[model samples]
Target: MQIVNENNLGEFLERKALKCKEAIKQNASLLNRFLNLCLVFDECKDDLDNAHILECSSFKELFLKKAKEEDGYFKITQDIKALDFMQLNFLVNQCANFLKSQGLKANDKVASFLQNSLEFVILYFACFKSGIIFVPVNACYKEDELAYIYEKTKFNYIVAEDELLAYVKCDVLKLAKSSFLKSILKHKKDFIMPKINPLDLAMILFTSGTTAKPKGCKITHYNLLFAGYFTLHQIGLRQNEVFLSSMPNWHIDLQATALMPSLRANACFVLLKRFSARRFWQQIVFYEANISEVVPKMIELIKLQNKFAREKKHKLRFLLYFLNMSNEKYLEFKKRFKVDLFTSYGLSESIVGCIGDNYYEKMSYPAIGKVFFAYEVIVANIKENKLIPLKANELGTICIKGRLGYELFAGYYEDELNTKNSFIDGYFISNDIGYFDENALFYFFSRNKDLIKINGENISSLEIENLLSSHKKINNASVICISDALACDKIIAFLELKEYPYKEEVNILQKNKELKQIEKELITLNLRLAKFKQVSEFIFLNHLPRNYLGKVRKNVLGEIYGRN
Candidate 1:
């Protein structure tokens, strides 16, 4: 059976959700998870004819529709090659078969710690063909980040680039980039492809939370479709339009908005290995891309490179820019590059491009625009057990109303308490402060208030502090982000020493040597951190400044770093 009986799929997902919750509490492994591959729960076959899942297109259905198309393909600029629709679908199925060969079962999890390479994309889609859940671990995550995600996910298999194999601590089945790439191309094996339900979990994307632990957002197949369709309609994409982006494929912008939208609209996509200031315009020119994704930081970097003239003849229709930029720079960048910026706002927990600007009209630089269709956005607050909707020009919390697993994310993976707490009065409280003008145009005030966005990726200060505090020689650590002219934010770590507290001691020379050693070890740790998360500098502090409420004054830390 290529498809699970939709009637039974819902019950199965419900059971799975409960199972996940129990597993989360018990910290247990999935026992006897390798269900004999062909068991299709035939008891519910009678109820399959009128199931709603059949009405919607899963990734499998999407692939089948485009498999026969001869004109559409994804151009991987890094490899200098393109995979036509037929070959893309064929390879994806083959990857699925390869997973089956390793005893992976439906609902089993595989952690993909990879960059924006072809294998990453193929393995992701293959999970849909088979019924495994895709857990995308940040490719740049260090041993600490990797271990945390590994523990949370309880992955049955892991796929990483050959260079990153040392970071995989588990003995679970490992697939090195070179071996997997060669193996998938060899033969098409005969295997029964499980039919997928639209509501089934497709991916678990872990976004940093205010706490030390990251929150894994559960993305369903239907949510992926909805996000893509919404963004495609929002931007008014046309068939065969070439979309391009260099953001990590693990990010929502690249996957939901750029890639999925292209597939939904029957458009082509261009994948770059990473963003480059020097080659930014050249890739667009070379690829003949009609649309590209960028953040304000990237725009700033590209501007500083001043290589605009080299690829001035690029055919990019517009740049889908995110976050706010200084109006002076925003206007100057547009006038200088002669390209329109498509500004939009979204979160990992929300739909991609959930709120955005309509480029068709006169543009507003800071206003992120209104909510897209099939979802509702309201700015309000729950005061004294009552819902109070804010009027125009009134600042309040921005909330989104959408059906779970469709318009919004399913919930935080295996975190039912947070998932339950996140929703209030039928709306997902975004915890973002914003206001709408009389024109119903929404402006972003702040989202992820305690989080920092460096190079379009969100990094939680608490996560950094939690990791740094674990160092044996360090008594405590405080992290702060400072503004930069080129990079969006620069992180500075203020550490409290366990031994070297004062400089006037007689053993100062020995302490200085120990300090140098500690700094060297930290440099190694910083190297493992995603480049953006690496601290620009480290400052020794006896104690972090705290208010009477006992909260670390990060602002004070930033000030101290600047003063030093």
Candidate 2:
């Protein structure tokens, strides 16, 4: 054979490499399908064999074991009682046994009506061990709202605080917050732990009913545990840190984002009875809290407190922040408080925080941040019975897909038709409009229903609400379009003033002066804004009706406006 030259060998190698690259490109789609199929098959094969599921599938043993491994503890500030890992486990066991003796069985619902206390938390975790479905009722619910929840869940088995006993019609296990541990101490007996399937429904967190009738989200043990796992591994949660929160135990933010994640990381959660703007920061310093979560309203209230001097001694790394704030306020708040804010986004159905942004400088306008963990996020347009993927900066509905029962909630409880309608092409339709940037950072604009077309131009009511709330006189604000189709989607801003006493109790002259001055400011603001963005009218209210989460119920406001 003739000896091959270097140039000839190089040409042959290049030809082979070209063929290999072409083959890879041609099979790329097929390869992706195969990999996805593998994941599905792996999921199917998973049983009690999977570590996380194994631990959660049977709660008592693995739970106690994990607690021991982590050496975690929880401090309740209400009574100043601290429970170590073993004490907590023992209390949960007692609580679980107590529930069992009350004729509750697997899948039976237990509604808990209490504030953020150890009892509320113990009952929640105890449900996991006992295989009972836990429902944390919003602390803010009055008798009428409680009646509605009772009608929906048909749950007669309720654990209520002594004060809240009058609000519900249930087989009551009433509690006094100070004597919670003593109340449970009387029931000391070991009971057989029920077999828990990881896929079994664990909790039903209700959506904010101010917007509409609350829908109960069916969350599974796997969903909750995976949320903890996601935060621990993907979000870089450190072990054994102290987490402080006054968030109501009823909230998904308190449970999935704070409680469960802290559980997995072996961190201590310092329980505060309620949020106090005056005492909250000092308490943070007292507890040396590493992390805390807050809504925009909390931040706004704290900013209003306007406490002088930067609090330099606190161990707070950052606020696990939500909703929106102006860029000016965001910077000032950080400078004033001496603590950073980590922007994040999630919902009741999304489990834990699925999107977050920690970098400060990039937040010229806060982004919902890039989708995290194994979630499949997309901004999409559905038209003509087709789902089309949207590009960067193109406004569209946000959609997410994940393994149901693990990453996402199973479905809306007992509402099969609505659940079916909620998902399109295997993706959960969020019904929220936003856009993704070139870097895939999502920016929330408004709820799809909250978006209004004024003079043939689309406007986000939230943008108006934010601007109005930024005003010194305003306490809270919500913007809604007039119901009159003839009025061509005229914007109306409903505002709650800072010093709201009873409407009848307010000094007439002082109120009128404040209104006239605000009206003049609105006129100047109107001239400065886009023609279509200007508010047609603004109404002052004693209080903007809100749910437990402090979200303004625009639908309710729309109804109120219609009547007025």
Candidate 3:
């Protein structure tokens, strides 16, 4: 752990304050224009209730203006504006009214299986506005995965995309048949929407299923409002700011970092159906994006582009992306792009972007800045069943509490045992281990469950991956523990070589030598690893299966390894 400089933090806050002032001024101007227009319309119509009509009309007018302005400049891109917010809320109200007309209550949980699109946003906001609990299923999930979530959550209504509609088979269930499915299908187009309060359950985002089954994290309007506002203030977002988001909206990064903050600031949000490394720069230039939320791997791909190829592009001012970027890459990016790179840290259960470090501040360490507003974070030791809070600079599990903290989730949907096991006192246990520096900057280590145990020794799989990544010949690697009937669990290494045999190039023999070198590197890894952690077998694959976020799915790897 390292100490954060007070002066640097103060400077960052000052800059944010200025940006906020600018945003407020712009908002005020827009509001006044709308009000003036409303006044004129009210004077001409004697029967119209001047005050009431003006209020709604003013809001709508300003919202429309903002949306139109953003659409004009940022064409052929996804940009969330005041009008999009109003429209989404209006649609949500319509949906809720429709659901209520069919006898569903406000507390009824509604599941959504859709990709990142305008429809997804509309449905999500409608759920929030109608007081229905929005349960979002991962788009990548198969039939079985979707079925598990539907059963566990006991969703009363399911709004699925046309492509995924076939997977919702209610007839397949044995007990607790969904009665609302029939009503939902019957009144799909005739459902009434409702208005909602700010304290409603906005969304339930599930955790990434890297090691185990995903857990649903319940998030409320209060959680989003607080986290969204804090992120905007921290990152210095302003009105009319153009934001490019490549990450999936289902993930916390796009939801908390890009979408929510952009909406709160009245900034433009540019959405992409999927990321294309070849067209990233062109898209950014076309949209004139000021801010972008990107993963480390995406940034690496962007950095690989030649400067001459990108010479005629529009410049970006601020980039809210991942950290731990190599020094050489960071310098090269800064010199070539001339933009500030900021980093943030949070999990799906944590409501996303809880801690962040700005680029203006010198990043000497992997510090996830000071805690955001209304979040009390502490490092705690997990011993048996009890949680003990550790002192600063002492490594332990991360515990979060406060108004925003309690909103993590009541529990994992239907997983009572694991949910009951996750809490320590009133605080939600994050299950991730890390420590805070003297200056209160948090540093993440690894997941508690991700640690592999062999012969009473605990080894981090990330450590093995990092070690393998250091080798020049190995392009990608994934380390997982395979069950050995005799030895409990044995270390298995999967290697993807940088130089692979290409039929077009006729380099099969050279590629074979490269594969052999990768094996030699594995032997060296065995020398460095502890006796129990040493690899018992090695598997060579053309490529490793990774999620859009670049995280290796060990379960998938295990399945593939078994098949081979």
Candidate 1 clash pair list: 2-195, 3-195
Better TM-score candidate (2, 3) = 2
TM-score-wise, the better of 1 and 2 is 1
Per-model C-alpha lDDT, please? Answer: 0.70, 0.64, 0.58
Query: In candidate 2, which residue ranges exceed 4 Å CA deviation?
Result: 1-78, 170-180, 209-211, 306-310, 358-365, 450-564
Measured with C-alpha atoms, the lDDT of residue 553 in candidate 1 is 76
How many clashing pairs per prediction, in order?
A: 2, 0, 12
Task: Report the lDDT tens digits of candidate 3 across residue range 1-564.
Answer: 111121221122223334444544667465532221100000112232223322333223424443243311111112322233333333334545555664566668777676565555645655654567878776665566677677767887776666667777754322111232233233332233344444456667776422334567667666665555667777777776677776665676677777767766766666765666655665566556777766555666777765545434564766775534555766776687776667676666667566677434554234667676556788988778777889888999888775432335445555667666667776777777788888888887765546664432335666666667678877776788765432346888777667654232211122366567768767876665435556777777666766689776777777877876
RMSD in Å for candidate 2, one decimal?
Answer: 18.7
**What is the C-alpha lDDT profile of model 2 across 1-564, one tens digit per residue?**
111221221122233334434544566443321211100001112122234332342212323334221112222111344444444555676777777767788878888888676677678777777778888887666665677677777774787777877777544554545565565666763445666766788888876421335678898877776666666554355655677777767777777777666666656666667777765665566555778877665776677664634356777877777766677777877888887777777777888767776433343238877787578888899987456999999999888887677778899898887688778888887778888899878898776655654422335566566667778888877888763422235788887888876453212223387688987786666554545567888788887777689677778787777766
What is candidate 1's lDDT per residue for 1-564, written digit by digit as tens?
A: 112222222233233334434533564221211110000000112323313223322212322333231222222111333453444555666787788888998999998988777678778877866778999988888776788888888889999988888898876899998787677765483335677778889889998756566789999877776766678888877776778778886788888888777765656676776776766676666556788988878888888765544356767778887887888888878877788887788888885878886646655567887777777899997787445999999989888888888788999988998898888888988777889999889998876546777777788887777667777888778887777777467888778778655442112122367677887777677776767688887776656667799777777766666665
Using TM-score, give the best candidate's number. 1
Error of 1 at 99 (Å): 1.3
Candidate 2 structure lDDT: 0.64
Off by over 4 Å in 1: 1-78, 189-192, 306-310, 382-387, 472-475, 496-528
Best by lDDT: 1
Ranking according to lDDT, highest score first:
1, 2, 3
